[model samples]
Target: NGASRFGRLRQTLAGVSEKMLTQTLRTLERDGLVRRTVYPEVPPHVEYELTALGQTLREPLKALTEWSVVHIEEVITARGEYDDRAERTR
Candidate 1:
């Protein structure tokens, strides 16, 4: 999205550091899950987009993201319940 800048990606994913983000991008590129494009110029422009193989991940990842958004409250509630039970057992 937005020409595939790192800042935009970091914002979307949240909590990704510069180093870890670079590593993740390289890993995906190596695995043939994503393609990196570079434009040769001063202050070179770059873009990262999913390859066909990577596009295959869209469905599952999208589903997971949607599920988290929908069920985050339930997850937090479960965590609280577990912590309460643990405290009571101590």
Candidate 2:
């Protein structure tokens, strides 16, 4: 999903600390992957979007998301089996 802003991107990519995410974004921007925009307002506002190279990631990212959603059951089942096998051997 295309976010309206950088804050939105941070929120969407869960479990990332704000500071680390900020630095990561800066690096990506430096690498010419993400575009950052600043809007003048009383407090100021910022937005982040993908550059052409970044946009190319959309399809694979979406596919990965779909795979996680569709194969969640298999993932869980495999995890349980692994844990059980480990416990028996222990």
Candidate 3:
């Protein structure tokens, strides 16, 4: 589907609260990166989708996400080494 509800997005992100998700979505929509559509129904149904500009950013973001996943261990190890060096200097 081109659009997704707040709950779906929250679940997809895992551990994101309703308020945080709402704020993030609102920010994205306000910045012209996301489109929010509200449907008139028995209960108001809202959906969010990436705008064209947002779509353009997907690939690079995905690549960055993948890189982080791959390098997380190395990053953690480097941090520990740096911390140890700093402690030794003190």
Candidate 4:
């Protein structure tokens, strides 16, 4: 909903390694999809927030999530069919 510090993001995204998260954040920042802000303090503070361009993806991503939930069974069935055909050719 707003800016998120690294620790907060790491907590929210379970199983994501710090290195991977840092890389992903850097990539997003480079792509203009996210903004990174560093604050001067005793220990230094940093936060990441989505850019306007990134915010535009919220609806589309949500739609995709909904679609996947609805069609997951079909996707699994298609994968099984493809695997069966491949096994027949071997």
TM per candidate comes to 0.77, 0.68, 0.84, 0.81
Q: Go through the candidates in order and give the clash count of each.
A: 0, 0, 0, 0
As a TM-score, model 2 comes out at 0.68
lDDT of 2 at 72: 100
Best by lDDT: 4
- State the weakest 10-residue window (summed lDDT) of model 4: 38-47
Task: Summarize candidate 4's per-residue lDDT along 1-89 as a digit string, tens digits.
Answer: 89999999999999999999999999999999999999999798999999999999999999999999999999999999999999999
Please report the candidate that would top TM-score against the real structure: 3
Question: Tens-digit lDDT track for model 1 on 1-90?
Answer: 324867778888788788999999999999998888899978887888888889888899999999999999999999999999999999
Ranking by lDDT: 4, 3, 1, 2
Off by over 4 Å in 2: 1-3, 39-42, 88-90
Colliding residue pairs in candidate 2: none
- What's the lDDT for candidate 4? 0.98
Off by over 4 Å in 1: 1-3, 85-90
For candidate 2, lDDT tens digit of each residue in 7-74?
Answer: 67777889999999999989989998898888899678987878999999889989999999999999
Candidate 2 to native Cα RMSD, angstroms: 2.8
Show model 4 residue runs off by greater than 4 Å.
83-90
Compose the digit string of candidate 3's lDDT tens values, residues 11-85.
899988888888999999999999999999978999999999889888999999999999999999999999999
Q: Residue 7 lDDT in model 2?
A: 67
lDDT (0 to 1) per candidate: 0.88, 0.87, 0.92, 0.98
Query: Considering TM-score, where higher is better, how would the candidates rank from best to worst?
Result: 3, 4, 1, 2
